[model samples]
Target: MNSEAAIRAAQNQWKHRGAQRPAFALPTQPGQESVWDYPRPPALLSDTRTVQVRAKGNTAPIANSVRALRVLETAAPPTWYIPKQDIDMQRLVELKGQSSFCEWKGAATYWAISNASAQPVAWSYEKPRSEFAALQGHICFYPSRVECYVNDERVRPQPSEFYGGWVTDEVIGPFKGDPGTSHW
Candidate 1:
């Protein structure tokens, strides 16, 4: 089967197996934080880390930013919001045909992985506001898809299946059927 076929098959399987409109009970946001809004990476993240882009012959070096934004963590992986300045923008090619709709964030633009050696990676963002302007050109990576490194040591993605705060270390829970996950 072709890549698109494989993707469609997988998506179909997931849709069939997943709960029909799971409830999305987002965790309570901390004081000063909006209700399950985007999260920012810790202030201590290093810019000199040895990041890897798992695309098709390219392992582009990346500048780690202290500014990753977390959108959500599901029964899958933690979603990170990266800043465009922290990434090697040359590898992100805007995709004309891919798009995703989000009620809160708005319409997202899609970008495909362009590196030959890096594994295929595609990213999208619903329309983001000025508060999220840092993420305008940046793309977040799925810990399941991309492996990050700090110097020679590998940095692990957050462990929660239902949370996406880049600065927090606790991986919350098996929140599959939580309140508003139907659209996820």
Candidate 2:
């Protein structure tokens, strides 16, 4: 099968038999309805428009890692979503960065990674508003771009994927590549 077909079939197999999906904007009570319920809120929630990101630990060898440095979280291996203002602007080296658009978010600008003691790691977004700006200060790493370091030890990411949060240890499922896997 073609890659797209294979992916579709693989996705179909992941459906759960018992899962309660949340209703998008159903009424919680007789009178509750707002952005809280799909009602609405002020256009802007916060006055702060910018956030920053920094590389934790010593993961500066790979470009993807630096790109992942855009992640913002109080915890480590934060998802890379660094806002333009949150990043250390002086250290960044904006190459002929590429751009892409997400259906939910807006345009994304990629940056060539740069570090003080090592080579570049990855790219990041600068102005990512539209709800996702909350992802500001966070970074998402390219599995293909960097040498992942978990607790000071280099850890190889699972193959056939691109995005990852270097720190989240949540076990997803008996995914496609999981052991004892069968044909799609």
Candidate 3:
């Protein structure tokens, strides 16, 4: 099959469509949200909360913004996409030829910090699918590789290296990307 057809087949194989929380999902308290309650194909929502990204051991943020876009998909923590304008572009170097495909979004271009190691620390969808057009010109960081904060609260990296979701106090989950959840 062609890549597009393979992606379509992979998309259809997901067992959880986000319509309801699974039996193993954690219950949310007031002011909290269950990732399971998020929708399939995801939702792109504007966020006004302060989002900040800093290099490891660096006090200054390389990217900071209150005008972020949050991508909320089922069984995963929310991924924050900062506007390109808010990022210090001079400090980032795009890793050419390193890319990935997302069934819901499209192709992603990876990036690394210029003075840091060559490992990718962030990614962006330069040309997202029509449904996720707002994501263009925005970038998302890997919390595992950098310090990330949401409204001043530090974030935890989602459980797997394959996913870049940011876990925070307000979001609860038996999140996708955890062990044995490849089928999610």
Candidate 4:
């Protein structure tokens, strides 16, 4: 199959399209959101809650903002994307030749804290697909790699290294990236 056809086929493999929650999904309490209820293809929503990111062992935050954009997708915790202006650009260095692609978001460029570990702690889409054009000039961090907080609550990293969803008390899940959830 051609590339476009292959992409479509792969995208179609997701069994839960988010129109309804799966049987195994945990019940959401009041003031909580179930990841299962988020839509497929994802939805980008503006968030005004304070979001913060700090490198490990650092007392100062690398990024903090109330103007974050959240990408919510089926069975995944929301990944908060902070505008470039809210981040400390001087402390970040682009990792050349390191990149990844998302079927929905297009290419991603990785970034790491300058003078710290070489491991990438964050990533951004410089030229996202039209559907996600708003994500340009925004960056998202891996909670596992850095300290991340949303509305003063610390975030837990999504279970897989390949996924960067941020988990907090407000979002409940049998989230994607956990063992045996690959088919979702």
Q: Rate the local accuracy (lDDT) of all candidates.
A: 0.44, 0.36, 0.93, 0.92
Arranged by lDDT with the best first, the candidates are: 3, 4, 1, 2
lDDT of 3 by residue, 1-184 (tens): 3277887896798888899778999999999999998998899999999999999999989999999999999889999999999999999999999988888899899999997888999999999978999999999999999999999999999998989999999999988897899887
Can you write out model 4's per-residue Cα lDDT over 139-160, one digit (the tens) per residue? 9999999999998899999999
**Model 2 lDDT, residue 158, Cα:** 38
- Estimate the overall C-alpha local distance difference test score of candidate 2: 0.36
Error at 184, model 1, angstroms: 8.4
1 or 4, greater by lDDT:
4
- Poorest 10 consecutive residues of model 3 by lDDT? 1-10
The TM-scores of all predictions, comma-separated, are: 0.48, 0.40, 0.96, 0.96
Clashes of 3: 0
User: In model 4, what lDDT does residue 106 have?
Assistant: 83
Q: Give the TM-score of candidate 2.
A: 0.40
Better of 2 and 3 by lDDT: 3
- 1-184: candidate 2 lDDT, tens digit per residue: 3245553454355322223222332233443222221111112223222222235444333222223222221111223343344344565555553655432334555554554433334444456545556644543444344544433444334333433434323322222233432321
